[model samples]
Target: MKKILLFALILNSTFFYAQELRLLRGAITENLIVNDTVNETYSLYLPTSFSVDRAWPLAFVMDLEGKGKAAVAMLMNAAEQEGYVLASSNNISDSLSISQNVLIANRMFNSVFNTVPTAKNRTYTIGFGGGAMFASILPTFINEIKGVISIGASIGNLEILNAKQPFQFVGIVNRSDFNFRSMYDTKQVLNKLKFPNQLLVFDADRNLPEIETVSKAFRMLTLTSMAKGYLVQNDSLIRSSYNDFFVDANANVTNQKPLLATYQMSDMEKIFYPLMKLDSLKESQKTLKRSTSFRQANRSQNSYFLKESFTKEDYSYYLEEDIISYNYANLGWWNYQMQELNKLDRSAILFEKQMSSRLRGYINALISDNIDYLAADREPDLEALNLLYMIKTITDPNEYTSYLKVISTSSKMEDYGTALFYLEELLKNGYTDTQTLYSIEHTALFRIMPEFNEVVEKYLKGARYDVIEQ
Candidate 1:
């Protein structure tokens, strides 16, 4: 056993020696292969100020499709500014079983732990969209993870949340993001469980939050640790951070954003109470909540929430039933509902517009969930996945992913006519990734046809291709 352990130690040392030679400081190193058997790889970014003498904070990022470098890039600036080591796995994927993916993640975690001096109390995992859901699940099973920064998604298994192992959660999502409601509810649940958590709301689509927002989240996690006595508290740092949040909340009040101001103050009070006294924070929350504008906005949002929830539940139920049964006849009804939502989006009333947006977000999320479920099966239902993609386009036309799916799947089935139609629709939707179009599965034969060449030429000037006549 000692001989075997000696050999293992030598292997690990040799592996990391090679890594140390390539792991440059202050920039992202893309596709650092970890396990050769499955081609398991990860991207890593280390702060320029890194040293082997002291433990460093680390963040594990998940990118669903295994775009490790892309995900690393999104958080690299924040990680550098905050002096945290960032790593993302290129092999972890949404299509893989959760257990399988988690095992891969565990390997990556063990590898990183062995390679670097990681601060155990500061280890965090961050992910976006489906990847965010994966990140949220880590703390429940992986006790080493202390926090999660979930962007554009929420916790998957609420039943797994345990007070015994409470983890810090910082959710950054846009107001119009499909997962906003779920994230909001998650914050409430976390609060009930007395967990350290904050949900930052921005105003945009499903995308990475600003670098500043990411930095703030990192700082908040640090504060949580300090407040919990896991780290030595710096009074100056505590005061400075508290003042920044308080000022931001006051600024929101001045900017005619009473609701936002109120929530900000509320979060501050909850997060900072254990660290220091906050008379001003408490007062600010009361003032904003009592303000007429805040009251009115709150009432309007309540009404929108109720209506949106009803629509979401109804659609979720019907969508699941339809997907399970492959009910194509209901496509027309879904289309009609989409048209109605379009009208509501254009409505004069603000509440109507908000409700419509939430409803649209809800449906898109449901379809995505259904597609993911069907795709995860050992023998996936391609027909059902295709149908969900089609529905995704109708509900969220601006999303180019669904169009690409429809085109690829139709071409694979030799349904040239359907492929051609979606190809044009994809172009009309402003999808300019021509290289991606040509590289899709089973598209070689379809792209070489006369009709495709004609369309490509019309849309992309100076584009020409020889059509093969078989």
Candidate 2:
């Protein structure tokens, strides 16, 4: 029995050693299989400075869209510069149930933990979009996770958080993201719960944060570790970061962005509270609050908050009603709402413009999520899919694919009238891909109808059918 156990141990060691040899440092390794039995795979990156001699801080990156390599690449530069290890599970998918994806994440975590020498109490989870929501709640389940860097998503569920098992939360969000207000509120809750947190905002239409912001997030994590005595402090880093925050706050004030300036000052207070004396910073904050610009900006923000809240509720209620009743006739109203949102874009008021963008994005996300929910069933509900596709075509007219889906689903139900209407609407939008138009599923008979070819021939120079009489 002893000899058999010894042999088994030897075999395991050899297998792990073989796996270790293949992992490369200084670059991304795309296909690292976790184990033979489970076959869980992930993309991994180690900083050029990495060595087996020292335990390294590791980040488990979640890609809600399930492209692990892309997620790894997004943060690879930051990880390399910050000297942290990164591993993202290729199986973390948006289509899968939350619990199922979490299980897949756990498998990848264990695999990386077993293979890599990780720093004790310095682990983190980071992601963008759906992955960001997943990352925010991960520390609650995986007690070892010390921090989370969530971009473009607010915390998923605040009820599950335990104050005793506190972890740092660093959120990076766009000023125009609908989740902006939610994250701001979350920061207040975190403050009351005595959880360490910071929120970084950027103004842009981009989905992913710039590389510099990502690097700052990594720096913040490292700085937090030092503050907590989890890692050794570098005084130079602390001094430089403090100065940068000060510079940013002053910049915001100069730009007449009192709200952003206050938020920046608040972040500085929380992040540096444990590391140093904040008396001077507090005095500066007080003076900033006393300024006329601050009071006016605060009042303006409060007024806009009401408008945003009312608008969001209306969207939620109307969208639910439309989806529940398959209110085809109300499609005009949805189109009208889009037009109103566009008018907000032209409004001279910046806050109104931001609210408009947020509402538009929120509605699209709502529709897509509802569509995903319906599609997740064992058998998808075609009626619901049909309604969502139609709504999507109106909300996001240029996407073009939703038009195809609407055509396919409508034709399948033999709702020739609805299908023909969208066929023309799609052409009106200038969707010139005749090849894709020709191969729409469940359209064998529908496409041959004179109406379909007529719409196509009218848009394009010629139609495949050429059935319209000269």
Candidate 3:
């Protein structure tokens, strides 16, 4: 027993030392030092097979919510399988000013570069939603970055991009994501500039992409590197990738999706033309494109685009008028529209579902934009601000800011009932910042109320305020 115990202890110590030398693979290692001077930290995932002997590819993943570990986890399965290092900063947030966010990203980038033996010409950045926008903007500022994997959002500041500095772009978006149209438009511009880019589409309504989707993106990056002669081409890898994509595209055709099938066929040709022969892909693309289903799909797409243009214009016009007039009555109409859109989401036709999802996403985007505009004015429009926040609670109940605003404004107006109502609603949404709840400007009066204390204590486990007897 003593001998066995000694052997186990030795094995455990060896494993620990191995991981301590460089970040461990397969599990997320949180708060790895990026900059000790700034006390900055980022989560890291080095594939379990990581070694300091050779340089490895790197991906800096960002989540606008600032959950570095969560972001790293999302990419860990993909990164491990694809042999890439993944890092995400704990400090970067969407609410920060552009400069602050840039600084945070720069610090992480420099730290990772200084610590990790990253392959030359293989560094990439990835982000979702606004974070995707942030990642898209990084290649412009940092010439060392070779590509961007932007999810759920399109490029930002296109003036910064030129043929002299083109980079690979891999966009993973969903049918219902608000930025689908923007991503489609950006693809057109990228093609015009002759930049290497690919768009991966999924049929979902969420922001973050699937792990297999991310893995495919990493594979695309690797293939692009090999095509550029930065990495040696492995015939086995080339064959495997082609087969995988071909099988998937053929499956689409089997399911009677000629549009998706044709896109996959065309994308495969673009991706593999430089790496291998494209005779098979060319034939498949030609056949799919000429099919009746393909023609119908094209027509459906064209009609959807036309309808979306008109709907977007109408939404913009109504939003402007509604905000200016502080039209609370329009809430019912918006609710009706949401239901109609939901019906379309359940439609049997894929195109109509895509259209309705786009419209709903557009409305939410418009609301967020208007809120920003209203909040940024020198003389803020309180009525408009209040109206928008309320709408936000309906649109995105998990976003706590709108509830906070409502509670603050209601308290200021001495409407204790309304204030208490929103406060409870905020708590129910999982808000636990007792200090922030008590410290919101114009909320001092309501903070001392017994009703407020009860609600706070119910959710937060401890009430900071004393309840005075009436």
Best by lDDT: 2
Mind giving the per-residue lDDT tens digits that candidate 3 earns over 1-470? 11111111122222133234334546777887764489778888878777656789999997778899998887788888999999999998878877788888888988777666789999999988888888888887788899999988889778789788888999988867768888989989999999888998777556667888889989999998999998899999999999998998898888877766775676677789999999878887888888888898889888988988898897788778888888978877666766777799789988898888788778777888888887889988877888888777766678898899988877777877877887888888899898898899898878887888989988997898776666
Better of 1 and 3 by TM-score: 3
Model 3 vs. true fold: TM:
0.84
Clashing pairs in 3: none
State the C-alpha lDDT per candidate: 0.81, 0.85, 0.82
Which regions of candidate 2 are displaced past 4 Å?
1-20, 376-381, 468-470
Query: Tens-digit lDDT track for model 1 on 3-115?
Result: 11111122222213533435667878777767556668888888877766778889999878989999999889999887899999998887789999899899888767766
What's the C-alpha lDDT at position 440 in model 1? 85
Best by TM-score: 2
* Candidate 3 runs further than 4 Å off: 1-22, 205-207, 376-379, 393-404, 414-470
Candidate 3: residue 122 Cα off by (Å)? 1.1
Q: How many Å off is the CA of 220 in candidate 1?
A: 0.8
- Which is the better candidate, 1 or 3, if ranked by lDDT? 3
